[model samples]
Target: MTEFDRRKFPPPEDEAMLPWYRGIFDCGFISLHPFFVIEGLDPRLNEHGTLVLEGKDRPAGADFIKWMDQLSAEHSKGKELHGRSVDHMAKRFGQMIGWGEMCERLGLEDHCELDAALRTHIKGLRDDLTDPEAADRMVRHCAANRIFLPVEGDIPPLFEAKLAAMFRRAGFTEIIAGDEFGDDECIVPVIGLDNEKPWITRDDFPTYGHLRLMAPDHSMLAWVHWDSFYTAIFATKERAASLDLDTTFEGFWCAEETKTFWLTQRPLPLVQPR
Candidate 1:
């Protein structure tokens, strides 16, 4: 195990009052995915959910780097990584590969396109993990989309029903259930394409499903989920206004370049079932 400075990633001072921070701490370990994916850190998530530092003697780390290096060399020579092609790697890792690598391997133009592709691929993987047709899908999906799926079991049906009722009360009806992939602890829902139809029930939805509310025109209005501690709401400005979220919770608009919505407080109390 590579030693990390706990002081550098100190627990939030207000964690007791903030549900989101509390929920993260409850997981028992902080993931270094963002550090690796965004900042090019040496750590990567292995199949066992352990962090492996690239080029280090932390046995797993060394093996992972060696494998990746071999794959890269083979790729340059127009060969597959081991027997698996780049396409196979993409389908297996989902969004874990950096945007540049994913685009290069998948022949995509940009990150936006890569995001769309991963969402579809991950959905299929989650829907049928045991299907013999794709034996490695589960492993690949987990490696790529860790923390997005529930580790123990599905979110409670009764809680989901209450969440649905809350959304309906807030005037959102075209809700679909599914997981969203992103860096933040909260799941982020993307707007469904025009050709896609919403699933009618949780059973019809994929595993680790969260509630995604859509506007009448199929634009995403909000992505909502409960982390067994508090509800996380990511909603458009207009939708957040409808819910009086700005007045009720501490939140901020996402980065101007990436999205046009507010990530309302880590743990929202407004919709918690009494």
Candidate 2:
């Protein structure tokens, strides 16, 4: 068998232990789903977890060219082009397909290019994690809205361990290991949003959406976020669908309502023995 056959999809144990609604910060619910397998050999994964398909995956690149050719046929007039222009195509592709696809079409398929891209991307994530202003902004947004960021590789191991210690110091009861999901991180369940109420709105957030969290009376929302990257909030599969959140979080979403707020209480809640 090839690389595809050797790697386990969700790994049998994870499939058994992780509940359907227990979503992680990586790969959306795609890994959890039974239908599709993770593309193991795809050369798009970088140090920072960004997937730059250009020059990385031949199949995806070929498909991109085929699509462009089809677009030309559909929009171009017989001898003289009437409908689609280069500028129009550029805008449309940028908006609809994305920059990665454009790169693939333009024959910029250099897998090594991801090195620089990862450096820049990871730096931005690091800034958000370290800078007080950026951290404040992230916490406030997460608090006010039920939004979570998905950061892949920008976190350092020491920082993650420190964050875990902080979580324990701050009074979170359980810190679960996230090894099965392919990362050096721990998961601290914020709240469980059961199907009954089915939501953890901004109001439900304990510390204005910062790192602080509470274990709800029920365990519906398997809330999680990457400790390395402090800017995102993770939702369980069940809650992710309810909130209409993009689980994979291919890129950061800019919130139009950019504002700031404060929190006095501890971010995560303390668990009292039942």
Candidate 3:
């Protein structure tokens, strides 16, 4: 087995500060939407799941959460969508990018604000589905939910090419024409960030750092896990000095605390000693 599968890959350094990027069912997935985590000296901020929006470019993700809540209340019986096998929901919401459901909820039938794009995508799926041998492609592209970023560093012929090839094998297209960490246009991964200095969400969450998680040695890798991607950021004193480097939000990666947030999944805590 591979090292990570065998639990041999070194655990990431900063369990707190690093932006955890993964499926909706990941542990470090808890963060206020629209927040971003940047690290190192890369000419491009492009990565799989790396959000490329400023503040308002996000398509009302909070509204999406509200809609998901509504869907859960009427459809899901208080059970989170983590590992629960629901074919119908997966097909309807997971496939068509929630366009159908959004339409249904808004009473927009099959045509509305952005139904054209949705319909085009859906038609492609139908075409693939009816054709034999298309099911495999369908399954992989439809249900794979795999990582889709070709992270190619411009360092050398060894590390950079190796990682770039690896991600490409996993289905990511390298679009880097220059010295940028170019990859697919962050297809499945979505992003949000905290812009207002005093990120006051008014909920259980007290405060947020550019780097969400931290360690006692300040040596943790500048990234965290969600379910599918790895995200990094700056830090806060509480988050920075407390083992996660002396970098605080006062200078870089500063953001307000998200008040209303929950992981909605089983969190596998990183039980590292301080």
Candidate 4:
């Protein structure tokens, strides 16, 4: 059976803005057709009542939700309106009048416009999914907030090489590069570990404590989730501060148990290779 390798399927060009679109989609503001089409994958509910792609044994719904939650948490960081966190405000308004109406009242018209453009682009009606104005806005937003988006193009060989070297420096010997997946081209940089066990029954997830690196823009991100801990290490302090780490951790519903460390102040840990 052919397994679905997430590393091989990189994120769409608009990865930085996908969470808002996905949140809108989840709220019934847009159809899932463009989302799946833009992602280059077709997923459906299997007989086991799990969302899966054809020929893949793994259930993908959990991973999809994880990705969404992580990105959405990051997207909401440092964004505020009327002295309330945008995420908090959204949730409150969503609960009262519903998400669709909340978006309408909040003037989130750009999301709908962007979704329409993506659908049109996929159908070959436009040369690009993003307009110059929107692109500029995204760039400025990321810059001002110190948010990092994946670089445009194939993952840089040098960046991957550097990540491998970092793992080696941390005393890992059985490093294996896992398939790239996610809109951010997240890849497991380490794989083999002593006494390793599957984190879950899903075949696509790593069976060992591994380090995953997402695509780099101004900074690189190495995420580790094992032993009931979820830690994300960024290449720079500014980048680390860009995210509301507490809020991000809370999104996992493990704030009380998870211990996060910023790489800017501490040495990276050497876990069994991914």
- TM-score against truth, every candidate: 0.25, 0.21, 0.18, 0.20
List clash counts for every candidate, in order: 0, 16, 36, 11
83-122, model 1: which lDDT tens digit per residue?
2122222222323333344345445554334333333333
Candidate 2 worst ten-residue window by lDDT: 29-38
lDDT scores in order: 0.31, 0.27, 0.24, 0.29
Instruction: Name model 2 segments beyond 4 Å from true.
Output: 1-48, 55-156, 175-230, 233-256, 259-274
Distance (Å) between predicted and true CA of 3, model 4? 5.3
Deviation (Å) of 51 in candidate 2: 4.4
| Candidate 2 lDDT over residue span 156-201, tens digit each | 1112332333334334555443322332333444333211221112
> Model 4 compared with the native: what TM-score?
0.20
List the candidate 4 regions with Cα displacement exceeding 4 Å.
2-131, 136-150, 178-274
As for lDDT, the candidate ahead, 3 or 4, is 4
lDDT of 4 at 110: 34
For model 2, state the Cα shift of residue 139 in Å. Answer: 28
Which runs of model 3 end up more than 4 angstroms from their true locations? 1-68, 74-211, 225-228, 231-274
RMSD of each: 19.0, 22.2, 22.3, 21.4
